[model samples]
Target: MPNTDREVHLRKAVLWLQKKDPTTKKIIQTIGPCTHKMIGNPYYVLIRSVISQQLSVQAARTMENRVKEYYGNGKQFPKPDVLVKLTKPQMRKAGLSFAKIEAVKLISKAYLDGSISDRKLSKLNDQEVLDLLCSIKGVGPWTAEMVLMFSLDRWDHFSYNDLILRKSIENNYGIPMNSKKEILEFTSGYSPYRTIFSWYLWRASVGIENL
Candidate 1:
């Protein structure tokens, strides 16, 4: 089910961003609304983000579809036992890289072993979630951030590690690209609404004027 209550949190963040700076306001005005919230399950979020890493959108989608097909339309994202049932060659036929196959299996193992669960994850704070997620193989800060923002509906998140976001920041601020720390420092003013700003930045990076 959708977390309707999180919408209030996001709305509050939008208000905060409007008050923080004129640039944010301009970006908000340009970008009507953020519509990036498509993920439902944290497991699916992890899987999709992992698949998307360093790959083009079309490639990622193609692979994702293949995996979904392999799992009968991904009714439950394939449990650990289900995943383990498949051979490495079968996973490769589903378009997963050898490394990704291992990574997904590891995540499935974590899930089945009761190391991570939706209920447990719901009780943890953002940093704790990040720490826990990064402990798994093939999952990094960027993928964790996606889960936080899209799946968990966190209002405050901005990935300085995202190159497109960095490019957009440079373009919007008319400044040279700098370190992640510097970018984070510069974006501090838009706290709580950094995710919204990130949406705009990503849009701008893609030459989308409407944002």
Candidate 2:
């Protein structure tokens, strides 16, 4: 429901996935419809993803909010120009590690310099987008993958870097994460809709009904 514009498209993807893989179908039936939240601002998405690295959900939210409070207006995420001005101490006060602080700065700089503009990225293919984002020193494959799913809404992405997705695939289908070839081969069936498949996998991992 998060992406109203893509509801019909997602429904089609869901049906395709249900037919393509039984494990994914089961996850969809259990978790309900795909509810991938799409954000228009790629810069905001990338920065938040950086902040969330290696942290619990609650802890990451707290830190992200504190950073927003310091550099942003109210609860709104700060713009690249605003966030570019953030000092190391300010980032530290918000619980960002030294590496994370550097990552944040690099992301903000990428936006400001037009190395990764939203408009420009929107025009590129998924691989191109990934390459452009990964060119930044702090942005990794995982962060770039997050942008593809949450920001650009690319449909075919499945991140091997996402531990939750890897675990869910292994738990549900007995596909070991270490077997990159097997994982890619298995997930290839959901091509052009793997993003939806991945969304269901994430929901299955957390037991959405219990929540």
Best by lDDT: 2
- The top-ranked prediction according to TM-score is 2
* lDDT tens digits, residue span 46-153, model 2: 888888877766787898899888878867778888778978887799889999888888888888887778899888999999999888877899889889998887
Clash count, one per candidate: 0, 0
RMSD of 1: 2.8
Q: Model 1 — TM-score against the truth? A: 0.86
lDDT of 1 by residue, 101-203 (tens): 8888888888889998767777889999999999998888998898887778676789866777888888788656776667788888677677787877887
Question: How much is the lDDT of residue 36 in candidate 1?
Answer: 51
Please, what is the TM-score per model?
Answer: 0.86, 0.91
Residue clash pairs of candidate 1? none
The per-model lDDT (C-alpha) reads: 0.77, 0.82
